[model samples]
Target: MSATGVVNVDDARVAYRLHGRGPAVVLVNGTGGGDGHWGDLIERLARSRTVVTLDYSGAGETTDNGAPLDLPTLARQVAAVSEAVAAPHVDLVGHSLGAAIATVLAAERPELVRTLTLVAGFLTAAEPRLKLTFELWRRLIAVDREGFIQILALTTLSDKFFASPLAAHLDALAQGILTGTNWEGLARQVELDLRVDIHAEASRVRCPTLVVGCAHDQIVTRARDLCDRIPDATFSEIDAGHQAYFEASEEFAAKFLTFADGLYSPRRLSSSVS
Candidate 1:
């Protein structure tokens, strides 16, 4: 099934798509992220369960209206998408900045979330190294866009991935970013990333939570702090860097499916909906 629409929330028009069948899984993309960022994993996950993906305001097809942004406001946008797509509860997968938004939703609107997966999430942007990295990103976007893209690739991929045979695939990804990146939207997201603070929200998430960490992530580090803050949150570490999900799709999917299947009962959506 294919149904794509927009949900109005405050000043933003959030673009969303719901497809596949069985159970419900809502995917929230990170900074400058769109559903396509999930790549092959989307098709794999969609094969067995209904998958919902959305564009945050100022990203992809979503409209920002030039409104100022904050973490909660972004979370509200995600919450709106969840309400439009899921039933009583839906499993949530959030990566990077998306993780912060998901954390807020699971905390403020616990009933809407069945389970939570925080991939490369952070409790705060106060970390000196992470903060410095974001600052450098913003500066690079202003002075040298290609340099910024290169830096992004550097921070996202690990040394082992570089040695692997996926250089061609990763090169294609970098090319896509260079050609298709939304500079304005990305600049805004970089600002939001520097300001994200979800420690309070993390404490309130009561649903079964998984915290995924990357071994060589230069962007977001100290994953244990995020896990420790969330009560009983489980922790898992992947060998790749920040973009582990993309670099290690099969492993990430296997881990994700295992966690999600244990929490949600499969409920297929009919081909046609009223």
Candidate 2:
């Protein structure tokens, strides 16, 4: 079973959950989502390694001062969680916005990060597609949240997923977003997404890093370039969409665990290879 707790970061109470027992691994969430989005991945990874998932300030169970979101502050929040849960260095995995924050953390607080895994994470706000998408997303959130979620689903999952019976889950997510969550927090995060540029910091990351790109991702088109900017970063592609972790959970977890084991447990790494 996972143990849940909260840590005070600045004025915010950052909520986190820890599970399993082995080398530590921290999973970060994307924009407008939290640790809850990682249920499937957590279940799989927690069996072998200690897994920590954090809810950013103003999202999930974490509480904040309701101030505008920024990369430095968000990165610090992640660092705090890592410091509290992990012994010394913890393997870090991030998706989308969480990836960006992880990059900043890996760069700024290199001592706390053992290895870094970035899934569908961009390094900067230079992508025209992302800029336009977030702009439209913010507008839709203010004017029509239901419509915003439907549109979000369009970009997150692939066409194959939409054709599957699981597509109903998107509707459920949309309904949850309509009734749950704070718009101010989301708006601040969207603004942070537009402004976050961790190129300088990401370039400084010296740890063994893996960049996972979605083959059919419609959201972030610059995953390749994002990897390129990082110093000696290894890149891999998943045959899914932006939400590949959800669309292809087994493949996603396999890729991540393979990389993680290679760094922390040579025995597990060799066993997996055999």
Which residues of candidate 1, in runs, are more than 4 Å off?
264-274
- Give one digit per residue, the lDDT tens place, for model 1 in 117-198: 9999999999998899989998998999989888888888899888888776876877888888777888999999999889
Best by TM-score: 2
Look at candidate 2 and tell me the lDDT of residue 23.
Answer: 81
Q: Could you tell me how far off, in angstroms, the CA of residue 179 lies in candidate 1 after the best superposition?
A: 2.6
Candidate 1's TM-score: 0.93
Q: In candidate 2, where is summed lDDT lowest over 10 consecutive residues?
A: 265-274
**Whole-structure CA lDDT of model 1:** 0.86
Estimated TM-score per prediction?
0.93, 0.94
RMSD of each: 5.1, 2.6
